[model samples]
Target: MRNSDPTLPPGAPPAAGAYTVPRTDPATPDGVGAVPGPSAAPDRVHAVASPPLVTHRECPAPHVLPGCAQSDGLSPASRYGELFVDVQHSGLFADSKTFPDCIPNCDPELIVTRYREQRATPGFSLADFVQAHFTRASVPESHYVSDPASTLHAHIESLWPVLTRKPMAHPPRSSLLPLPHRYVVPGGRFGELYYWDSYFTMLGLAGSGCGDLLLEMVQNFAYLLDTYGLVPNGTRNYYLSRSQPPVFILMVDLLEREQVARAIDFLPQLRREYAFWMDGAQGLRPGHAHRRAICLADGVVLNRYWDDRCCPREEAFLEDMQTAMYSGRPHHAVFRDLRAAAESGWDFSSRWLDTPAAAQPANLGTIRTTAMLPVDLNALLWHLETRLAELCDQAGDADAGDYRAAAQRRKEAIMQTMWDDAAGAFVDYDWCRGEPRRCLTAATVMPLFLGLAQPAQAQAVAQAIAARLLDQGGLATTELTSGQQWDHPNGWAPMQWLAVRGLARYGHDTLAREIAQRWLATVASLYTHECKLVEKYRIEPCGEHAKGGGGGEYPLQDGFGWTNAVASALMALYGDVAATCRVDVGDADSGGQPGHPLS
Candidate 1:
């Protein structure tokens, strides 16, 4: 099982500081290894066999003088090389994307020392050092800056040009973390392609006649799947240990309109992605579990969000350290919560809290996300399975039979395990307690969105949403006021889209349209005041919370990608002559027609 040679194959260790993905053979049966069997520990860990050892002592940049005094303990790459991470945690650099890349051919310590020395000298400013040593990623001012004149449609149209990243160079350099094909980034703090965010962004691109970009993004995802076994959370080395929600199947479905014939071409990658999620699934037996999979008392298998590395996130390093310090729990347990939160994409929600007493509610150490079968995660996998079966049927692949059978079993397990008969909703299942979490969040609508709910079930879910979750502005993430971005009063773009679409699917168009209109109006109101779209909004009646929908690590960000895209889509669907009249201008020069019906 062990090999000294670095290049033997993936799953075997590579050179000390290199990364290798465990590739699965497409033609082989049991291509991806199964989850451990009944005797294995239920809380077993599954991680990269040998992750690259990134340390300050072994700096990759060659400019550091060997045996120099500064080289004794300093890692420039750790401190200054990743400007994105530094600025995010710094609180000094307010704008995430406006910072310069690392200064080439210079030691980080020497640069910092010299910059300080220059500042002490007469008339010497930080800008002088920046001019001498660094280059800006782009001219932020030349690009569209937020302004009062900008409408949501205008901002979105402007973003298509600014956020679209071109393909990377061939035989990508070792230092490069870029993807091989063009893709759009969520704006402001996020300057790279994200896994789940891309799908929502594509919806706007497709509706706006930018289907070409949609195809290119899908091509990028395929490239990642082929190269890395699974797409990293983002196109970054730090994100390799875990992935966000699997939305590649949905991305492929969105692009099928233009390339329907090539739809089956993505099946191989789709199968591999499924294998990654279900890596431990096949070995499940009664009363046993493994990474990402577990067995219920009745022997049904289900999924949960998991991360291989149980540690603090690199981007929010200091915040995580402080949280762990105050958590009064073992460091290992805190790490699991942090990683599980990342996998959920609701990094710090009350949905993950383990106990009612728990010493304190905000104590992140109480997070038990790994011990719960998330409703949204399972529903997403169900969609993927259903899609795989359809594509297999089209291509006449023999795997069609297996996929259809898997989809059916998953649908049955979801209904039996997640359904809350009295609550009239689908709730996240706590594997430890063997009962529903009963949060009544926006995730309940996921089954409806996927068309997996019976008519009665869908009706109940809709009623639950209206009764507990929905507000005047739109749907809240959950009923709690935990000061987390994913909790109450902080309605997000993706959740709103899910709730609206899910309601519409179950013959509740009137309610769906009402929610959509209200959300769109909220967006308009926020834009009118701030002159920019944001990541999340205070969807409560404005006076409920102290600062309104604010929480999480940072302040509300603008140049928002998903918000603009989702708003554009909803406005197109619901905007009438009266709504169109509300727009400041008839149309803008950038091919932006704010009130025009989507083609």
Candidate 2:
């Protein structure tokens, strides 16, 4: 069926053949389109019917320019311009010229080439270069040229030219390839990674002017939705069973801002992606309390990370191993363990073992359930639902109103069930025990990101976070003394960025600035020391005796993707923090007293 309405947005290209929109009556029973409420509707949800698929070109080889022709009349600026001209012109011709023949013996190329080649040759020393470059001459007493501080500054100023002269070579822009695997767990031995996490990481990339990479990531997710019903936790065959949080709607928003037509081209994919998340609850369990169209028992929604095919429970490890082969060439065992750790999210808990009450045998086989629905996951899904409803409305779909209503209902359910009055923060429920887990993990602050917390609640959570979980650098994933790596004394880049943004959103400028500055400094310090972004950092002070430990089925892991991406985004945000800090600070500032129930 064809959509007769020309104003309706085009859907995703048809599965195998030409793309077509399924026709539905605008005024029929199945067409319950929601009216736009007071909130201003987006101008146009779908921008283009179909955008051309992206294409990549191979990077051209570097062209070596002929040495500059030395002329006595040429000034330094003119000489530099001449060199640049030569470099540009070299691309037209393939022949090479010797340095001395093309230019004078004192040509800059001679200096550069000699320096690099000498550095590359074994034992061809830089000791003489360092001494000559840094040493200062002693000034006579009458010269007035050597005030100690002034002299130091002068020396630094002089070094700048020499330092800048040796141009650092950047990787050919094209050679800096995107990771073939979208989501990478540097320490997670699992070869495949997750979907939603990649979306957040891609956001950081988009903000950093890596729009091409961001587009690739979005296309990847769209491909997954088209090929499979939904994107699984990762691309690996083993990860087909479960998914992480839903953030594809946010990804579409990013793409739309980049170019509207691009998003419209992918609308059908977006619709199906939403369908996958809403599948189980689409009238299947209408009696559920949280009448958001999707329902999970006990008001909990969203799936925890699971890899049913390969992840082994304690009781079935031997049996599972016999059938499930490990991905070959394991460079890091810790990463494999980390991947397994994601499965239960109860890092190091003994409950995963096959105790009578702990283990349950199901269709996938025997597995243990930690039975906690994370607050952050649900909050993210709620955000997705709202965005989806807006998309539907913009597309002129009749069911848009129902989606909006459902989202509002879910938001209310989340606030009622997850917000802990005694804890003064949002907490995840341990479903088995029917109680909130009072641990102070960074997930507690996620409600602020979702705008789920009230002004007072936001303030209390921020203050409590600063008091208990925050360190000199950033908020720890958990309280440091907890012994669980994921729990405490460890600070992750994503969580730190989230907290900084969350606090800023609530008008905690002073606290937010401190956290942002500390984390940025730590990241900068690490980058300076290592010349690379790392996955995670140990913010805990070292004890007299260095402790070696294990958590969950694996050792603590680091050098993560979400970490690097978040750190880069945070650094970018640092420039504008002071200006935006005052936007959200309000009457809640007074609510942040010391004893305000942060659990």
Candidate 3:
């Protein structure tokens, strides 16, 4: 994997351990009391403060949110519009997400009317106005602590209730789109149920004997499909304009394996989701794009991340606005790209940057998510197509053939456009640039994991995994550290699981086990002291110094649903949680060579 040169703005924390975790005790140092392995040390609490917020573009002084001025020609069409863009711009809450997530005490129109009434008055206070008109959002919190001696598996079991959200009887008007059944959130600042996150979280839920929640979560998504044209990025009104990576099919597959779900029952929902993604495919002309569907020059249809709305993300309004200001591009264009990246579930990664391998952290403004047809996303759609075929055939429907033909065309297109023989793996194709995005990410193994790759292709992908993507702790998200959560040194639960399952599918058991072992070790090492699971981990610098991964809008979060679930699932599949094989991970960096995953 190529190293990244981060070009972060002033006051932005570089990815140089910007997130600090306390070093554990010397006596029990290498502390893995919960699940012991080599260099299994616990980190003291993460103490590195988040970088100070900086609105990159200098707003005109005293203009009441200088970025909100109409002089820039950015007429954001948000219902909030210029009316209450002021609340976010005022920066009342430390986290920019706070204001958008707040439930209004009365109608939003009344709040706007009140704001207008009070705004021009001398000594008018935006903070006071907000306090009177809205209720602050409540971030989910857990005070439950695990016993120090409990195994990682047991701790995970105890955490299920903590992460689970019960159905609300009477919910307030907020960003959340309430579902009938209870579902799991990814935890921390992410308190809402995410579209793609539930699939990986289900792995742990199933292993910990919480399959009931898994079933309910799947049902909830189906319900969402029935209500909305497609499952939005998450269960939030703010997310209604976008959808995350379509993992709903995989979620149903997991339920089927448990012998509880029948794919035929979900045929309608499945078809609807596929239709949602392929909305503009049939009508698109060669070399044109619409929404999420991109048409190649060969007239082949593929998918790219996109959003229906072209405005700043409600949850990330301030940050998005700042990025647009810094981009030197039209605000609407940059806003669309930012939302599209969020829809990809890799909100910020070098993979979408103009110069992905730039020496310094590349400017956030360069992200062009809609320009690239991602290999993993297309592979997922292929699985969805094939699944639709199977279910349709099971129901004796004639459309099965249509789905099957679609699957074949998609697979062939993927191989022709995305497979880079020189890179020994599949890569994303930038349709706008007419080039390949060669950033080596753990996503390269998606085709193999889904059983969509030929033997030679799988072999080449496995070699690529061993040679570049692997690290001492586990597979890094990508080789570049661009101060993005989805970039280098950070290993996410979904990525690690995909690599492990994919490698093992191709009969590379040794490499699979090694990757799984290192990830489990890294997770369990922190579990000993923190007694908690985090959203992501620092896998590259794998030693006592290892801790939760950082770099993004939010701080490292605990009660992390996917991490807990993936950790438990890995323990069940690879080994007992109480016993992990010791791998010397601290000094095990390997240059691009076909070697051990944890070497």
- Candidate with top TM-score is 3
Please identify model 2 stretches exceeding 4 Å from their true place.
Answer: 1-193, 258-265, 282-370, 480-483, 543-560, 575-599
Per-residue C-alpha lDDT of model 2 across residues 1-599, encoded as one tens digit per residue: 11111112232111221111211211111111121112332221111111011000111221222332212222111222323222222222111111101222344445345555565687754544323322212211121122243321232222212211011221111111112223323222322235656655665556556566566667766766665556655543223333456667667777777652355566677667556545435444322311112235544344223222222222122222211222121211212233333543334322221222223211111122324556776777677667667777778878778767767877777777678887677877544345566666678777776666778888888777877777755567765343334545556666776677677777775776677766655554444444334445655544321122222223333333555566556656666332122222222244332222110
Best by lDDT: 3
lDDT of all predictions, in order shown? 0.64, 0.44, 0.71
Model 1 ranges with Cα > 4 A deviation? 1-50, 53-143, 168-176, 258-261, 355-361, 543-548, 576-599
Error of 1 at 447 (Å): 0.6
- Residue 285, model 2: Cα distance from true site in angstroms: 6.1
In model 3, state the lDDT of residue 246.
90
- Candidate 3: worst 10 consecutive residues by lDDT? 47-56
lDDT of 3 by residue, 405-450 (tens): 9999999999999999999899999888788987887779888778
Positional deviation of residue 244's Cα in model 1 after best superposition, in angstroms: 1.2
Model 3 misplacement above 4 A: 1-8, 11-79, 140-143, 356-358, 542-545, 577-581, 584-599
TM-score ranking from best to worst?
3, 1, 2
Candidate structures ordered by lDDT, highest first: 3, 1, 2
| Cα deviation of 182, candidate 2, in Å | 8.6
TM-score of each: 0.76, 0.55, 0.84
TM-score of 1: 0.76
